[model samples]
Target chain A: MKLLVVRHAIAADPVEGQRDSARPLTSAGKRKFEGVVRGLKRLDVKLDLLLHSPLLRAVETADLMNALVEGETRVTSLLARAPSKALIEALDEPSVALVGHEPYVSELVAWLVTGERQLARGFPFKKGGVAWLEGEPVPGQMTLASMLTPAQLRAIGRKK
Target chain B: MRPAHRELEPASDAVEVDCSAVRIALQEHVARARDAEDSRAVHGLRVACARLDVFLRLGRRRALRDDLRWLRRSASNLRDLDVLLESSAAGELDAQTVSSLSTERTAARAAFLEVLASERCEALLDALANVPSVSAQRARAPLERLAERVRRRGEQLLDAPAEFERHHALRRALRRLRYAREWLGMDCTAIRALQDSLGALNDALVRETWISRVERPASSALASATSDSSSLVQSLSAGALHAWRATRREILELPA
Candidate 1:
């Protein structure tokens, strides 16, 4: 099974009195991430389902990925919290793309690979970056197949 | 605007908490419990809810904490009072003490009935009816930790048989271990004796508390309930202490 963990792309600066969850992906963030999605398509990456946080930014990111990759997109509160066993258990699909916020996305990847949710020591999953994982969705039990930066993913998308 | 009832499903790997057996049991019990005076129905409801709680906790799925907790609390007080009422009848209490308990039981039934008829209770039942997708994998981490926990509680009780708090704590922990094993379709006979002992001991403890709080006419059923409950407390405690040691030994002997 392939687990694709993604950090939400760049978002507009917060406006006064705006809930963090309500923040939207910036126009540039959407345009750039489209290339990343196309890169996923270029590699023939497909999803059984795309899961995203209920927040606006993650939702928008998920929508973009779903457009390119053509999978069912569903909002899951599991991605809204710290990476938990519940989130891992929910990844039953053969391929799932989870769009979530920063450290949480990184921590889920680390937890999957190392059984420990250590953030500072592992691959710094930059905005729109992704790590493809393989194995049972158990903590410290998965093999990291690849970790791709947004630029790398986009370049893969741009290849003739 | 968003859909009127938009809610995302649980994570992809996990199935929802609606086991068919449990759901049927809950719906059947809920129907019977609506009568307000049916103690058997209330008892059935509590047992069903407890089974669901064990499954959810052991499965480590964070789906229904608040609703389950509410349902448990709703069923328990009325359940406790009903037990005391039954004990009162069997103990041959005087007419006045029985009347007092009956009055209290009546009020409890009314309150419980009101809760059962609430929108929240309806939601819980609706939630329970959700069918689960089959997934074959046992979550071993929580079970391993719980096994360690039950063993620790057993040891604490073994070390000090007279500790009131330890008896209560072990009683609670043992129930979790038993139901959790049953949920996973694993054998639970290993801890049944300890569970029975703890069950009797806790019943005595609860009966004693109720007897103290209620009216006790001399030579009446309430007094007899008191004496019956009191006489068994020491023996039940001793029996549980032995069972604790036995169960703890059994747990330790299993391949860790």
Candidate 2:
């Protein structure tokens, strides 16, 4: 199975009396991620399934990617925060895409690549960054095939 | 050792890590490294150097390896200095040692800049920019070949006991195999674990060598550092060898 993990695009910083999970993607985030989706299309990215955290920004990001690629978007609680084995268990498709938040997104990438959660330290993902891994969901089984920052994706879109 | 995916790629348009893309990222990292005005920059530069080294070797682009080697050599001291200073700032190192290392680090930083500013370094960057698109064969042929190479190298490490160079050779071989597997997005945990352990052991050895190169500020401290580091290296090395043997045996036991 091939897994494409992405961090939700830019969102408004939390303020007093705001629920962190309620924050939505900024307008700029939407536009930039749209361009990124276009670029991924140029690269022939096709997702059989798209999954996202229950948070607003992540759900929106997943919906956007699903609009560009042929996939069914499903909101799951497993991707809300730090990833657990339950996150992998939720995957049933041959090719999958995940949209979530920082630290969690990068953490998942590191886990997929190294299989040790502790090694996930320092693998930070920029807002809207994406990583691709090839392997089963099994621990220590996945390989990181590619990783692209949001800027790189935008540039690829421009080039194409 | 267990082939995670029996079929590598059936799609006619399967796009792997293209050489052009890799080159572009490599160039960006080199530029970022050059603009490295802080610790993060230095860390990024060091990582880029390591990745470029592995990519160059795996692709069999021997021509560009020397340039990368020079870059890595020049940056090594700077990286260590950054780590030590970071630790010092966090109150991990004593004031005297921090003072001593800070002075040496400044000089090392200057030396690294001199190396980076050389015409040869610019030429190397230019060469990397023009690295031809990695061939499909270059990307795919290693899948099967890497498994065999890992098995062979692991066995060799087991056969040649107590030789520093032999252990180093095994480390390099495991790294090459891991890089290759990483490119293919295959399960590389077994090899990666071995490589990381070897890397830690190698780091301990490097620290010992660096201590010998510098004037001993405190003889007792120097002796203590070397003794602790050497023992750590020995234990790590033994553990790595044991792991490699187990990995090799697992691979051998798998039915074709």
Per residue, candidate 2 scores C-alpha lDDT tens digits across B1-256 of: 1112224452222533434444455456556656665666666555555566556544554434545667767878888777645643354334566667778888888897787666556545554553433333565554456567766766777787677666777787776666555555556676677777777777666666655565536656556656777888889889877776667645333653
Q: Where in model 2 is the C-alpha error above 4 Å?
A: A1-160, B1-16, B37-40, B53-60, B84-97, B140-149, B219-222, B249-256
Show where candidate 1 strays beyond 4 Å.
A1-160, B1-18, B89-91, B131-138, B216-228, B252-256
Query: Which 10 residues in a row give candidate 1 chain A its minimum summed lDDT?
Result: A66-75
Q: What's the fnat for candidate 2, on a 0 to 1 scale?
A: 0.00
Interface RMSD of every candidate?
12.2, 21.7
B72-145 per-residue lDDT for model 1 (tens digits): 77877678878876765453656676777778777877888887787557645654443232221444555666
Chain A of model 1 scored by TM-score: 0.95
| Candidate 2 clash pair list | none
